[model samples]
Target: MYEHLEYYGVSKKVIEAMNKIDRKLFVPPEYQDSAYVDTPLPIGYGQTISAPHMVGLMCEYLELREGNKVLEVGTGSGYNAAVMSLLVGPTGKIYTVEVVKPLYDRAKKIIQQLGLENVEVFLSDGKFGLEEFAPYDKITVTCYAKEIPPALIEQLSDGGILLIPVGDEYVQILKRIRKHGTKIAEESLGHVRFVPMV
Candidate 1:
């Protein structure tokens, strides 16, 4: 998995986290053999565990630290949250939300099984953001949307980083948004396709 992400220019920290987190744990039983293949695999409910390279790229963009509090929208298979938990280490916290109940249950169980104590998975409308845990140091949205949800921006801490895909339903641009006080800076990472944010 680490070797496949090399071409994406992922940072050393993200690479280390990806290396430590087990992708097979988050994949469906039938897809277990393909878990380390670096591509996205179906996880039911019209959702997918993002490709390893994409995950690495998003993590690189976030620039996570050991003490940072992170928010993840669209938990899917919970693979991304697991890797992020590794990146943030034990001192940090990760709150991941999945709109689909079944997915949320599965992800929550798997995360617990893996003993990632600092990560929490919840079932809710991810677009609304988790207000109780506002001011996250980093936020990552796995799904695509026509626009950046205002709630997510407001939830980000000052000087925080947000990585999301925004555009039409069919196509979207992976963007990086940095918050400085009340101002924001946006940069398009690349064109990509992802399931629409529900």
Candidate 2:
């Protein structure tokens, strides 16, 4: 799996983080064999865990450092958050939110069982961006949004980076937004399909 991700240009650091977390643990029992196949898998509640490559791309593009604080808008299966936890290391913190109660509970339990102490899962509408932990150094949204949520942009710290997919439900363009003081810059990472943000 690491080699597959590396071939697609996932950075060495991100790949290492991916390797530490067992994708199988995040997958539903019926789909265990497909866990490392680099495709999205349904995790119930009409939500899907993101493809491995997408997670890698987002983490690499965000330029996560050992101590950077990260906010992930959709918790899904907790797979992406698990990878981010390793990328951020012990000193860093990860605050992830999921709108669905079942997903939130499952993800939080799995994260705790894995002993990823730096990750905190919250049950809330991801669109709101978890304001109490505002000023995140990096923010990642796992679901597709009609437009970039204004609240997320406001919560980003100066010089922070945010990665999200934005467009209609069928397809969307992955975007990278960089915050610099009062200025903001945007770039397209290419097209992708993800479940709606809701």
Candidate 3:
């Protein structure tokens, strides 16, 4: 996994998380052998685990800290959240939401199976931004959104970074938005494809 991390240009934090967390545990049992292959595999429900390279790129972009409170949209198989949990450690909290019920339930169980005390799962729309736990230090929306929802921007803490893939269905741009007081700055990281935000 560390070899894959290096191939993906992962940061120290991401390397540590991917190394410590068993990718096989997050994948469906039948697909366990392919977990650490640096590729995304189907996990039913029309979802595929985000490629390890992609996860590494995004985590390196987030620059997570030990006690940061993070919110992850589009939990999918909970693999990304698991990586986030590892980075945030026991003192931090990671709240993730998946729109589909089956996927949400699957993620919840996988997270529990992993015994991640700092992670929580929700069955909700990622667009709504889980405002109940407002002011997240960082937010990563794995799905594609047309624009950064007002709810998400409002929920971000001052100086927080929000990353999302934004665009129309077929073509999208990976965007990084940083909050600065009442002002927000945006830059395109690059082009990418992500499932639409539900």
Candidate 4:
């Protein structure tokens, strides 16, 4: 995993999280052997966990701290949220939403099995954002969006970072948006592909 992290140019903080968390624990039983291969694997319900390296890179972009609150727009297999929960430690919280009920339930159960008390999984439209926990310090969207969702930006706290993949269904451009006062700063993180944010 560290080797994959180096290939993605991820930060040391991300490397630590990657090293500490077991990717195999997040995938379905059949794919457990390939979990650390740095590639995405199907988790049923048409969703796939993002490549491990990509997850690391996205998390790195958030610049997470010990007590920060994070909103994860697509839970998939709950891998990202679980790794993030470790980064945020015991004080911080991770709210992850998955539109598919089965996927949400699976992820929720996996998180519980891991005893990640700080991570919460919800079954609902991720585009709406988790408003009950507004003003997240960081937001990470695991799926692709044609455009940045207004609700996500509105829920971001001042100086918050949002990492999302925006483009057509086939491919996307990873972007990092930083909220400043009433303005936003966007930076492209390069080309990629992901499942459409439904």
23: Cα error in model 2, Å: 0.5
Per-residue lDDT of candidate 2, residues 71-125 (tens digit) = 9999999999999999889999999999999889999999999999999999999
For residues 22-137, write the lDDT of model 3, one tens digit per residue. 77877888888888887888888777788788988999888788999999999999999998998988899999989999999988998998899899999998898898998999
Worst 10 residues of 3 by lDDT: 1-10
Q: For model 1, how does the per-residue alpha-carbon lDDT over 82-175 read when each residue is reduced to its tens digit?
A: 9999889899999999999999999999999989999999899999989999989999999998999999999999999999999987679999
Q: lDDT ranking from best to worst? A: 2, 1, 4, 3
Alpha-carbon RMSD to native, per candidate: 1.1, 0.9, 1.3, 1.2
Residue 169, model 2, lDDT: 76
Backbone N/Cα/C clashes per model: 0, 0, 0, 0
Question: lDDT (0-100) at residue 73 of candidate 1?
Answer: 95
Instruction: Give a tens-digit lDDT track for model 4, residues 1-198.
Output: 576577667877778887887888778899988988878899887889888888888888889999899999999988899989989999999999999988888889889988999999998898999999999999999999999999999999999999999999777999999999999999998999898888
Cα deviation of 72, candidate 4, in Å: 0.2
Judge candidate 1 at residue 135 and give its lDDT. 86
How close is every model to the real structure, measured as TM-score? 0.96, 0.97, 0.94, 0.95
**Candidate 3, 53: how far from true, in Å?**
0.9
- Model 4 segments more than 4 A misplaced: none
